[model samples]
Target: MISHCVFIRFRPEISRARRDALFAEIDALRHTLIGIVAVYTGVNVSPEIGMDKGFAEGFIVDFDNAGSRDAYLMDPGHQKTGARLVAAAVGGGNGILVYDLDTGHCLVRQAR
Candidate 1:
C-alpha cells in the first residue's frame, strides 16, 4: 500500500467559509477518483510548541500502490478539484507540504 500525505496551511486572510468549502471539496475526491482506498482530511488543532500550526488543513490518502498514487495525481477530477481548492486556500509558496511513504523512508517532496 502507498500513503499520500498532504499538509496545507491556509492563508491567514482566508475566510472561514472559504476554508470550509476547501475542506468539502477535498472530501469530495474520495468518490470522484478511482484507486483511492481511503481518504481522510481535517484541520490541525494541535497545541504542541514549535509545531508549524501554519498547516491548518491536511489529508491522508491510501492507495494500492505507487501507480494508483500517480493516477490520482493525474486524474482530471483531482486536477480540477485541486486547482479550485488551492486557489482558494493557499496564501503563498510555504503553505503546503507533501510526503510519500516508502519501504522505510518517508520521502518529503514539494507539493505542486
Candidate 2:
C-alpha cells in the first residue's frame, strides 16, 4: 500500500467558518471515491510552535498501489472536491505538498 498525503494552506482572506466547511466537503470524498483505501483530514493545531507558514489543512489517503492513486486523480468526485476546495476554502493561491509512503521501510518520500 502507498500513502498519498496532501497538505493544504488556505488563503489569507478565507474565514475559519469557510475552512471548516471545506473540511467537511473533503471528508465526504472518502465515501464518494472508490479507489481510496482509507482517508483522513485535519487542521493544523500547532501553527505557532511547529510551523511558521500557518498551513491550514491536510489529508492522508491510503491507496492499494500507485495505479489507485492515479485513478483517484481522475475520479470525478475527487475532481469536484478539489474544485470545491479551491472555490470555497482557498480563495487566493493555495499551497500543497504531496508524498508517497513506503510501508516496509516506514519512510515517506516526495512523489514525482
Model 1: per-residue Cα lDDT over 6-83, one tens digit each: 787776777878777766776677787777788887877688855865676778888878888898899887777677
TM-score of each: 0.75, 0.68
Prediction 2 TM-score vs. true: 0.68
Error of 2 at 101 (Å): 2.5
Q: State which candidate has the highest lDDT.
A: 1
Model 2: lDDT to the true structure: 0.70
Candidate 2 lDDT over residue span 1-112, tens digit each = 7788777767777787876776676667667666678878787677387572655577788877778778888888777777766564343335666678855466568899
Off by over 4 Å in 2: 46-52, 87-94, 104-112
In Å, residue 8's CA in model 2 sits off its true spot by: 1.3
Candidate 1, pairs of clashing residues = none
Each prediction's whole-model lDDT (CA): 0.74, 0.70
TM-score of 1: 0.75
